[model samples]
Target: MSDHTIRAEAPGDEAAIYNLIAQAFAPMPFADGDEQELVNRLRADGDLALSLVAVDAGGVIVGHVGFSPATIDHAACGWFQMAPVSVCPPRQLQGIGSALIEAGLRHLREQGASGVAVVGNPAYYERFGFTVIDGLAPASEHDQPYFRAQAFDRSAPAGTLRYAPAFG
Candidate 1:
């Protein structure tokens, strides 16, 4: 059945959140296996702008996503970065990740964020309005167009992007 619910992560879902992230990234050969720990660091450092989860009809957390503050040319107030989005391996391809992203973006818009950036599969993120613009790229190794942004307002800043220190 296709009836999972997308909701903000609660204070007590730490273990489940970590497991979901671990499970989702296990198949990626390039994964360094530190994504969940990064989430913890983000939470500990107060950089997590938002954290959301997709709970199946059976009340199991099957997907998750996080947004954190990022900067462009030293400006830190308006832009955010979406990262470490994950869904349980069994839950992939069921729209759970998409729902998490859509809900997170809606929440960010409601919070008045000016933009969101992500480094991900180009074909997948393009559906969410993320596009490569000049002068914006992640500090990570990947330099492809998958480093993209979706501007909430009409203007998108042009400069190097620095994700939160927690990403280190």
Candidate 2:
């Protein structure tokens, strides 16, 4: 992880970030071919709570992560949703995604987020303290096994974990 640096996303990273996300999830069966569009809508709608990127020694963007404000009952709680976490095609399993998640979570905490939710692999996200919460998930994947949450407040909220309108 020392070889890669994680930082907040800056201007001029849109294209690279889009490409990286598209490339990373290109092989996934669950992908709706809308990951990049989701990120774009989040950004355009000012719902992107945190956008982070991992750059290698040469300053090449190898990974990216986006956390957007989520609603429990339609914007009633201070929660965030880890939208899309992506690593370059050749850079998978190299800790780049982990670094991005760690840094992104830290930033969310600093921003006073109460909890975070994600629709991701349980095995990989559990290391970050994400666990499935009963009845806590996106509208479409309600109560699915892959839905997970980690509360910085130590008390995860109840209700549906509604992502930004972009996720729809």
Candidate 3:
């Protein structure tokens, strides 16, 4: 396995990040043909809590992950929603995605975030301590079992998870 470093994203990394996301989710059924738009919207809104990228020794981007503000409609609560986690198709299963996620989550926790949510593969995300949250809804009404969450602090709030307007 080649060594890859995961770090906070830089300004010039947008195009590479977009391309990685586009390639990773290209065949998914739920995209509705606007993956690039979603990426752009997230970037433009400045709602991202943490945007991370995995790079090779030479600094070539191989994966990307983003977390933005999420709410649970409860008190003393501020959570992050993980979205658009993408690993270059050729780099899948090489721990790049894991690095991005772990690094991003650590950053969020350091920033005092209470929790984090994710709409992704159940089996895969569960490895990162995420679990299905009943009665919690993604910003949309989409019925997906992969819509899950995890609290960094055990005392984090609980309720229906709400994402930003970009998800609508």
Candidate 4:
């Protein structure tokens, strides 16, 4: 709800984005503590399909959301994975994260992306239209409960969805 602008990640934004993500996830019980590195790896491998950052009125980076190409059944299916959505500790719970996610999804829709998948809290992500597809699922069984998706076009594809290599 703060006065912030959501925009694509720009040059020199990496460091700030990195710190922001790290700080955001550090307190989460389920965080793997490698999210920051994952973002770096995604960028390094050119697998970052989309990365958006939220800058507050003071020009401070407060939130970020990343999207990467994901394959369905071992083949590109025009689908993407949304991950590592982060909001600075002090800026969180204020709708900044949701705003970042909406902006990223909007951009992907505009680019004609087939759909997007996410692994997270069902109650939270479901608000964005993400749902568990009967046949579509994530690679890891442990992620089954958290996996949710949204298709931009027609019905969601049914198959095993794999995240980018960096997710390994």
Candidate 5:
């Protein structure tokens, strides 16, 4: 049986979430080592539209995924950015990260978000229906190649996609 359950972040989950994120990204070559801080910034700036955590049977947070509002063409298009998906090293590769992401996306959809964007491996995000739209792009040229998006009930717009300020 699975040892963890996915759910919304609670008031005291910040410290656990931060530690887990730092541990999860520490070994990744692409990680900038500020992902944990980014999450804190998002929460402080009130840009974290949604945050979910995976809790083990013992009540420890083992995974986390954050969703923040984003803009397309510099307009409020109900788009969000999914980022820093993390699973503790000891608990990695057990689908914990994927489950957190799916739960986050599902919540966003129910909340009427028009779409979600992510900058990551195509092979991974593609499974969640994220794809590169011909005319849709990220504001940062460095992110252009890795950026992908998935539209929900509404059609995605073409133009620069800006992530929340905490992403800077």
Candidate 6:
């Protein structure tokens, strides 16, 4: 069994987190190298809701997950958007991703977030209670099961899920 713990990311973890994210997501689709840009923008914009990491027993960062601010028009609803979730290549499928996601969602709930959105696999995210928002358009054309949402508290917003400009 892998010895791992999930916790909020720290300032000291910047380098490790960057390296882990680059290595883990180097093969995926979507904007490449934009992960770091998104992270930087979120931090600079003061919109990061939660930045979490999973570390092994030896203190190696193996996974990272981030929840940033998402909004829809005039409503001041707190929307959590999950992206750039990365798990070390060797650590993939060992539950690190799931753990990070769960921990991040829990943290968002405790922080009083109204809802959370994700642009990811529905099959995988469904385990965390995510569901398709009927009648809700995605922020982009890419929105589908991959761009889904789940209400950590009450129901999710019924309109489009507008991600931050950094996502553009």
Cα-based RMSD of the predictions, in order? 1.4, 1.5, 2.1, 0.8, 1.0, 1.8
Which rank order by lDDT, best down to worst? 4, 5, 1, 2, 6, 3
> Given candidate 1, what's the lDDT at residue 108?
94
Give the winner by lDDT: 3 or 5.
5
lDDT of 3 by residue, 68-156 (tens): 78777643267888888888788898888887888888788888888888887788999998887565566455646668887777574
What residue runs in model 3 are displaced by over 4 Å at the alpha carbon? 74-76, 134-139
Work out how many backbone clashes candidate 2 has: 0
TM-score of each: 0.94, 0.93, 0.88, 0.98, 0.97, 0.90
Model 5 misplacement above 4 A: none
- Residue 102 error, candidate 4, Å: 0.7
Per-residue lDDT over 27-68 for candidate 1, one digit per residue giving the tens place of the 0 to 100 score: 988689999898999999998879999998889999999999
**Using alpha carbons, what is the TM-score of model 5?**
0.97
lDDT by residue (48-69, candidate 2, tens digit) is 8799999999999999999988
lDDT agreement with native, every candidate: 0.87, 0.86, 0.78, 0.94, 0.91, 0.80
**What would the TM-score be for candidate 1 when compared with the true structure?**
0.94
The candidate that achieves the highest TM-score relative to the unseen native structure: 4
| Candidate 5 or 3, higher TM-score | 5
Q: Compute the lDDT for candidate 3.
A: 0.78
Steric clash pairs (candidate 2): none
* Tens-place lDDT digits, model 6, residues 1-168: 459988888888877887887887787776477786677677678876689989899988889998888876635588878887899899998889988888888888888888888877778888998878776557578576477787766564677778777777
Alpha-carbon error at 168 in model 2, in Å?
Answer: 1.0
Off by over 4 Å in 2: none
Question: What is model 6's C-alpha RMSD?
Answer: 1.8
Return the candidate ranking by TM-score, descending.
4, 5, 1, 2, 6, 3
Per-residue lDDT of candidate 5, residues 1-168 (tens digit): 288999889999999999999999999999999999999999999998899999999999999999999998889889999988999999988988888888888888898889999999999999988998878899988998899998897564788999999998
